[model samples]
Target: MYKIISEETDKSGMKVLNIDKSDLIELMEDYKDRKYFLSSITGVDMKDHIDVIYHLHNFDKNDYICVKVSTTDEKVPSITKLWKAAIVDEREQYDLMGITFEGHDNLRRILLPDDWVGHPLRKDYDLNKVQYVSVDRDGNEHVSFDDKEGW
Candidate 1:
């Protein structure tokens, strides 16, 4: 029921299905109903596009499959409704890869502070600029590029 773009195997011999971003939720729902559990979500920065990978496991058969969708606009549908495990996984991807998981509730940084400037995992992330984090007396954290403010 998925509009697959291609099917391939990763180096580790895991099945990978590259499908359109629109079909992600439907395919995930079917997988969920078939007793497949969400293993994890990983994001890869391909420079021109971002690849979002969903790992699924079927405990009954001891099978594993990966679903991949590539996006140029850095957006994909959120599978959090079908898989509760996607809550944190999606957040992590969003935080580090700069991908926007559309319809994701509470989509925000899981590792970096809200004010952090950029997604460090992205290929184009600036390494020359230094960012600092400091907490104020009220226990509120602040992010800044200015070294003096951070101290």
Candidate 2:
């Protein structure tokens, strides 16, 4: 349902494609037949939107491809079904960028607690309003925020 918006080669000589999120699954399915390895998934919190980037490598061809999907709605379809390797990456992205991956199995915060309020990586995240939490060796949890500094 989507088309490639652009293509380019990075400094590492890897092929990169900026595509619509709607077309990611179909494109990935096509690459699956060629046996592309899922290298990594990264999320960028752009001011206007969030970008999810997927890196794939075809070892046989000595080639790498990166697919980028930018979404303003903060949501995208999960490709975890096609590449199980994306599980942790997807969760990390969701936790940090506040982007949701629909249909992802076990999508949850990977680096933050369940009670964490905001995505720390977001450009608009308020650091001064952050809560500080500490855990003792005895497994006691202490959560507090700086009232004077608002941090």
Candidate 3:
């Protein structure tokens, strides 16, 4: 059995189960054969590594278990192979935190542009500004959108 943590929530007490990244599917498949369904999948950026959180609940046990996958290589295990709901959340995590879900059938940018560089949700992100677009030296005029908005 995986170690469980009792995380305090505003709504009351919520039990949290912590599982290793490599064994995520193993944990899922254990209860999966008993029909435990997935509830949610999301991520938190921790600078050097990204933490992908997966929440699954068992109707029979009435308990919630979570799995965390962390990696600095930008490659993540494909939980999409087990849980279809992970498709969107994994894409969003990749787009925002730059965590690549390896082995995913179709992993792509979900919210930001395909060419967008850098993860927006990382702890090291600069909040003072989104990002400065480079000035086009090819005779194109550059104007700050804020400056023209007054017109």
Q: List TM-score per model, in order.
A: 0.95, 0.85, 0.70
lDDT of 1 at 140: 78
Predicted candidate 1 versus true structure: per-residue lDDT over 1-151, tens digit per residue: 7777899999999999998998998888888999999999999999999989899999999999999999999999998888889899999999998889999999989998888998999999999999889998988789988879957
Query: Please, what are the lDDT tens digits per residue for candidate 3 over residues 1-151?
Result: 5443333333445545555566666767776787777887777876667677777788888977666666667676777777788788888878887777778888888766555556778888777654333345564333342444223
lDDT of 2 by residue, 48-115 (tens): 88888999989999788999999999999998999888899899889988989999979998888655
Stretches of candidate 1 exceeding 4 Å from the true structure? none
Clashing residue pairs, backbone N/CA/C < 3 A, model 2:
none
Worst 10 residues of 1 by lDDT: 142-151
- How many clashes does each candidate structure show, in the order listed? 0, 0, 0
- Which stretches in model 3 have alpha-carbon errors above 4 Å? 1-12, 129-151
Which rank order by TM-score, best down to worst? 1, 2, 3
For residue 129, what is the lDDT in candidate 3? Answer: 58
Q: Give the local distance difference test score of model 3.
A: 0.68
| Rank list by lDDT | 1, 2, 3
If both were scored by TM-score, which would come out higher, candidate 1 or candidate 2?
A: 1
* lDDT (C-alpha) at residue 47 in model 2: 91
